[model samples]
Target: MSERAYGEELMSEKILFVDDDINILQAYKRQLRKQFDLHTAQGPEEALKLIADHHNFAVVVSDFSMPGMNGVEFLSEVKKISPNSVRIMLTGFANATNAINAVNEGNIFRFLAKPCAPEQLALSLHASIDQYHLITAEKELLEKTLSGSIKVMSQILSLVNPVAFSSTSRIKSYIKHMVETLNLPGKWRYELAAMLCELGYVTLPPETTSKILANQPLSSNEQTLFDAHPTVSASMLDHIPRLEEVAEMVRRQQSNFSDYTLTEESILADPSTLGGCMLKVALDFDRLINTGMSLPKAIQSMSNRRGVYYPRLLQCMESLSKVDRSMEIRPIYMKDLTVGMIADEDILTVNHMLLIAKGQEVNLPMLERLRSFAKTTHIIEPCRMRIP
Candidate 1:
């Protein structure tokens, strides 16, 4: 492809070259600095330091033979830390085996023999840049296009079953805090799982969803249906491309911690399983709080459930309760309600019927519905709300 075909945007992506010899590194900079936004490091150590400091490096080229770390080892670290950056290895004839290992382990995009022509090296760099763009473009499509469509579907479902979706919003917040507390990776998957977790509630009758939101007892038949909702939700998500992992998390959300029994090392080995564990904790905690249990009491109750959750995940809840206690709760009139405020308690009618569930965020549709209800039925005014 022509240089112009790559576009100025793609051509501007940063490139890094690493060699143990400072002279070879300087020679690469002198030869190709004008053609690429190039940076050089004397060895693998300096290269890793640069990688840690910089956010956007489109290509990383390293010599195979280094003082401490070989090209394969360095590039393997790059794969873990900056998987999107295209990796290329340069090696002598004797180091060809290592170059091949780099391709297998480090996912190296291209490798060049030492003493290569400048033109051939430039061509390889251009190819790697094109490859980087392709990788990023696909990721953008998944994040923007696919996720956007899912969000639109979620909006529709929210309108249809606000009680279910509102509970989803509250659970999502808990999941977010847990993910942050644990310093988990692939947070977007957990977020999306939380967003879509309640989709199956849309299939139930409005009363069934209301009973669930109110934490009321369900008939055996209703309980059977309720237990199957995760399966239904997972089935829907499984059809979407690139969402298989998220689907698995949804499917396994109801799994008991005792059933899994993964060791600390094994718990992190499978991110989807960990994600499911987070969802279980969040969902049950939301249920407890909806039953009017205080944050501390709900966490205490969860701790009492011997096989329900991991102790560390339960500890995250304890820390989260500290944040919850610090938040200010105030009373607001129905007409004064606005979006983004969370309901501190269940909004109820004068006759003791639940109108809105606790922990539900105030949204435009909910606000309008409450207003219409007030015109016909008496609502408990000066309702309690929490400032997030």
Candidate 2:
């Protein structure tokens, strides 16, 4: 096949046609089968079931006049279930008001009169498929570009202030576990925020960062700067594409749950603030652990703070701690090291200078550097990593 044909085939070829009338569905199958991979449903309910089973459909066409659910209503549900799928409304009794309502409320891509010719329908389907591809492509491109920029920024921060960034890898691990435990969507943003949360520390004096990481008491001025880091990080990330939500979460990471009068129910209702709560809990837990508190003691300390951390978040951490203890840690040579593996303990040079910290997730660059370093300076043989 040609490139364009192959691309189209790889993209979503499935188109769903929903109508109460059997004859109309049969006509659609006969007319659309050659140009499109078609699926027909008798009503909106059956169409929804199909959508649930196979979540990808390039376009969904529904007749406006149906027995129980109108075309507008069905399309609106489709928008929620699969927002990327293009929607079209077909009605025998077309009115200006109905068309406007369908377009506005249901987000319908096209409003077709019942006597839509095969040619017109085909053109509409082709346009809808093109639109679906366009939306998905734009989203994928934006995510890739933003993620790459963030990763570079994080590496720079790591090099500039190793102490501040040392704990960040651990913070990211915690955030990952919390997100997975809760089965939250859009985990990339949370993980990204965790990785870059300490970006603002790059501006702090090296000695100040050292003190903070060592859990030494900071002077009033130093404390103020430390507290302001979240806002600074948020400001730095705010202008990046698709990072608005992540920035907001970072800005509110230090906020106490009791600071706001809003109940958990209210906060959970708004996804933006809920993300902040997650960040807050993760940071607090990391701080407690960094202070040399035992896992149980850290959980107890956060619990004693009452409204400082969400109760469910604390419980998730406690559960994760138990699971983490059971995880097997094994030693491997530097030559065998690979990406996506977490370092079980700090990897240091012969003089004991920290090269990679415990709980740090290894990447390609770090792996390459370790391999190069191993040739001259003897690293403690058999570097340990958790097999997760």
Candidate 3:
């Protein structure tokens, strides 16, 4: 709660978007409102009223150059109340200065230019969501999951950014909805496919999490890098062949979203699978909500998303996220003890192991006398040696 920068991704809980222009509001809703759970306001007063209701919008984006309240002033006030919610400024050339001031004094995230492209807006909002998740996770780590190192890593990763952990949950929700809504072939492969689609992101830079979540169009260089992420992810699990099929699914989630034709023998989509479409759209929707599309707007946009996603899959997403949306808790704890757990400090553990590996024993004097007679791999897994 000390407000230091975090190195993980965090997707906030909800979003609120405000603007004076009805057209802008409507355009945003048209683009992404249905894709996310959204709350919208036409002006500062209405926005303030919504905030007063304690809706806890994780990310708030406002247009600059409003009638009475400018973007900076309105957001400045918002920062005071929901100090945790990420504030973003959307401004034209005239309001650029004010937006920068907001970024400085208000501790706002990056500012966007007026008439912001849907992709860019979505990316920024996703970043805000990521930040929120990180802070929440850190707090949870302090409160709960500090006991075991493995548990702490899990809680920190999941709580800080549900995007990583929620990949499984979100895909599970998608499968349940798709199986019921689309009435397609239900297979464990589909379920497995959904869960592991984003495993590639584990090795990705935290900055790239927002970019991927936002579904922002990637540049040529970025696209190439992203294209290789699947391969990178697969390498991590190569030691466990039980997960190879799942790795294949993750690698192809984005690759199969094409108009190109495929043969029946091909793994690519033929007529198009609702399950496949849902994952991408859901991923995008999650980003849009983070970007600041009010819940209603996000839902509306997802509903209105024509050829971008299957109608049946979108319907399921709408039903699942809007109604009976369950929030999972992040657990953590702390304790002192023992060896074999992941060491917190690398220098101490690594150097000691290295010295032993180089034929220098330093544990018990008896062990040194024994090792003086024989030399081999000193440190072994399930290291059973405590003394000579």
Candidate 4:
């Protein structure tokens, strides 16, 4: 329920410059120092350390050819670590083909030739910072759009996968309790993450979605697809630009504690933020609780798993889940709409008489048409009257 005003942070008001060449790094640092917090990196490894250290960068201008990890590899890593930071590549010998490849592969911003002009670097940095601003601005816009989208999607998901939707919402409700119980981030990141986490289900078939709802174990392939759902959801939102970061946290939510994997490495996809840890914990609680496991059992299982999730979050989930579901969420309905009433929440502005017509997409247009039909039919309320 606690949603903060988003995007108070302007953009990459801070910049980090990376190159094996100390001179180049220092030169840019000197020129852009006043405008940006310029840091130097001798190599990709060093640059990553700087990212971990400062934990913030508006833009990164890195060399193409570096020991161990090249520019593309470096930015790919950066993308995992810092979803919002803009990246540009600096190269000397690479051809247009190579640069294009790097840009596509790395998801880079701009390219600067080797021994670049001072103005060019400044301009790129300026553009990158502006790009950061644009990026945040876009995410904010989508967040607004999706604010309503989540409520609608949750309702759709309820019909598609009722148990999953209810369970997920319960987990979210409990997570909210935990957050308030502990005074967690006084921001909307957790709420936003929870709202969009189930988005990947959009791509899931009703049958496949059913199995997950049935709370049955998935096949290896199904499990893999489920694991990759975060990326799928991220891809869907990535194009919108504004939901990039939320999409990111959503994508990595399944990085649960595995005996074979490291949560820090997997959950720490973005080293710049600790929300990954929070998300991992949230997912862990959902996985355990949705299995009908109790909080003590969940905690014990987690302990046995060697800290795949934060215990504090688990504690909160357990604590909240106990008193949580007591709140009966009142269902909002239009009077003309019956229990079996099927009105499009989309196309139709007004509620009208509509039955759940089979095979229809139930989108905006169909709903609009149904509303028009409702006024015409003028059926009595679906609620039966008491014995009189």
What lDDT is reached at residue 380 by model 1? 92
Model 3 lDDT per residue over 1-388, tens place: 2222221222225678899888888888888664455678999999987885663788888887899998888988888766677888888864656756887777878788777898888778767887877775775564343223323343344433444443344445556565555443323445555555566666666556546655577777777877787667657545653445545545545543343244322422321233345556666666565465765677788667555554545556666544212222122111111221221111112124322211111223323422432344332223322121
Alpha carbon lDDT of each predicted model: 0.83, 0.81, 0.56, 0.61
Those runs of model 4 whose alpha carbons end farther than 4 Å from true positions after fitting are 1-12, 52-56, 152-170, 173-264, 267-388
- The deviation in Å at residue 145 for candidate 1 is 3.2
lDDT of 4 by residue, 82-175 (tens): 7688999888876988688777778888977878888877777767877887987887776667766665766566555433344454445554
lDDT (tens digit, per residue) of candidate 2 on 1-388: 7968755663447999999999999999998787788999999999998886666888999999998999999999999877888999999999999999999989999999989999999889888888888987987788778778778777656544456677776787888888788766567888888887777887788788778777689999999999999899899989976888988888888888887778866675455676778888887777667666878888888899988887777888987754332457889889878886767677888899777766566777777778888998889878888666
Angstrom error of the Cα, residue 374, model 1: value is 7.5
Instruction: Give the deviation of candidate 2 from the true structure as CA RMSD.
Output: 5.1
Clash pairs, model 1 backbone: none
Q: Among these predicted structures, which one has the highest lDDT?
A: 1
What are the models' TM-scores? 0.72, 0.72, 0.35, 0.49
| Candidate scoring better on TM-score of 3 and 4 | 4
lDDT of 1 by residue, 133-248 (tens): 89989887778877777766776666555567777677777889988887775578888899898778877777888788778999998898899999999999998888999999
Candidate 1 global CA lDDT score: 0.83
Stretches > 4 Å off in candidate 3? 1-163, 183-187, 214-223, 234-248, 255-275, 294-296, 299-306, 321-388
Considering summed lDDT, which 10 consecutive residues are worst modelled in model 1? 319-328
How many angstroms is residue 309 displaced in model 1 relative to the true structure, after the best TM-score fit? 1.9
